[model samples]
Target: MLKNVAVALVDGVTPFEFGIFCEVFGIDRGDQGLPVYDFAVCAAEEGPLTMADVGFTITPPFGLERLEEADLICLPADRRAPVRDDYPEPFLDVLRRAVDRGARVLSVCSGAFVLGAAGLLDGRRCTTHWLHAPALIRRYPAALVDPDVLYVDEGPVITAAGTASGIDACLHVVRQAHGAEVANTIARRMVVPPHRDGGQAQYIQRPLPRTACDTVGEVIGWTARHLDEEITVEQLAERAHMSPRTFARRFLQETGTTPYQWVLRQRVLLAQELLESTDDTVDAIAGRSGFGNAAALRHHFLRTLGTTPNAFRRAFRGPRAVA
Candidate 1:
């Protein structure tokens, strides 16, 4: 199992992203019967490393050599990461050696850029924060970049989407290394979910309606509340007092996705929440989440999340429903 954990810090590391790994791996919960990893925070540079947009500097207790002993090495978000190409050669070398030696590496948000610079992400599926997705693609043409998901676990290399998604990715590591019960316990202590729904896609910003019209916003709220019912763009357009084509155009402009995609994502999110929080069977969740039947729910769940509903529930709900 994963026991030794180390964080490799470069200059301008964002505090929250760095904190995620520390919270997940560095804490000693031996009294609670949880495994305690040998954790260290190591610096890549010589002097006090500067934090981004902050007034203070940090001097890590360990050096880059500590990473050579780690079972898992974490890279947190650095403010200059998108344009940073000056990572120390020794720092990059240790990363490559870690992978070649069967150790795992995880990058949170813009930290993926550091992995990209080290050529760790070449030909592997990875992700960064959605805003940096385009720049990541431009910088590393060989990487398979998926911008919508919360995280990707490509065997030895794992990448998370943004600040809070770092929490998800770290818990995922814990879940895989330890088990669901241990990960869920850690999540409860941190006041976070062991698993989360949807993706960074929900948080992406879009241009508002040019005419300052809030009709689309109202329709979105209405659709969210009535997700169990059959919803069509025609019905939504009539409610917005606009033609179907006009409504579709305005919806895309205001929401960055089509009406159909928006509803499908919402329904999937609802199914995920119900599966996590309720004792409902798959068929019940399907009816409540607007999937109509278990087969439909399973199909969409796989297409959207790459996992079946029963497996997702088993991950989060302790295998209560066997489908």
Candidate 2:
């Protein structure tokens, strides 16, 4: 029975996040046997609202008062959202009131910050884009912020991390309210996955932040240059002109990771490059990236990236690319 969807817009709103809600709820897809909600875009502040990083202004058809009647209020990511602490009180109040009245409030990316300001996320499990998760956590300590998730559905409050995951979250709402068949049909029309679990880890790739190493500098550079070779701490220590124990300690101090872990992490980055740019077979890429074989490559890749090599390729290079 979920209907009357309204997207609440604020200053510096991101068009992509706003568009996700529109694509999911604003459009009239009833002709295809889909449930079309009563949707409207509302402005939180008066006058034209500027888009984030874009040189255009959009005038919403409705105002903050319109949110009071909504079955679902969608809050999209905004550029000023994370730093700009002073949100319109009227805007935040309506959101709180809506949730109190049993209306669901869904936020995408940094839009969760608005909910946090409204005190809606207090003591509730929520998530935001991984890049912004730390900021969210620091700002809203009362909110249980999980950075490693695609989305979190805390009953009436749903928070989605990043862009595609926002789409996944919306489809999740559709799946819950209507049925799996409806959600699947909508996913087919949008050409996206029908169901990506809320618990799926965000594919976060944190590369080595340093090319300029200290003490163990030469060894670090040498390791990067020779990723395809089976490297050991003893070999690295000898190359660094130190004992194995001393080298290991210095390696941890200088690079913040053990020799073995650094090698494995770098090899995965190399494997990612091979998968994306080159038409290399998984087995071939595995050996070339020093994984010995595809099985080892798959194991390390999944462990670090939370996704399989083939799946990563499909997502990065598109479904047409042969894995």
Which has the greatest TM-score? Answer: 2
lDDT of 1 by residue, 288-309 (tens): 9999999999899888776778
The clash numbers for all candidates, in the given order, read: 0, 0
Candidate with best lDDT: 1
For residue 155, give model 1's deviation from the true position in Å. 0.6
lDDT of each: 0.90, 0.88
Q: Candidate 1's error at 62, in angstroms?
A: 1.3
> How does model 1 fare in lDDT?
0.90
lDDT of 2 by residue, 1-323 (tens): 89899999998999999999999998899999899899999998886999988899999989988999999999999887778899989998999899889999999999999999999999999999888887999999999998878889998899999877889999999999999999999999899889752233426666555634454887888888899998999999999889999999988887778889888888988898889888888999999999999999999888877788888788778866677
Which 10-residue span in candidate 2 carries the lowest summed lDDT? 196-205
Q: How accurate is candidate 2 locally (lDDT)?
A: 0.88
- Candidate 1, residue 267: the lDDT equals 90
Extract clashing residue pairs from model 2: none
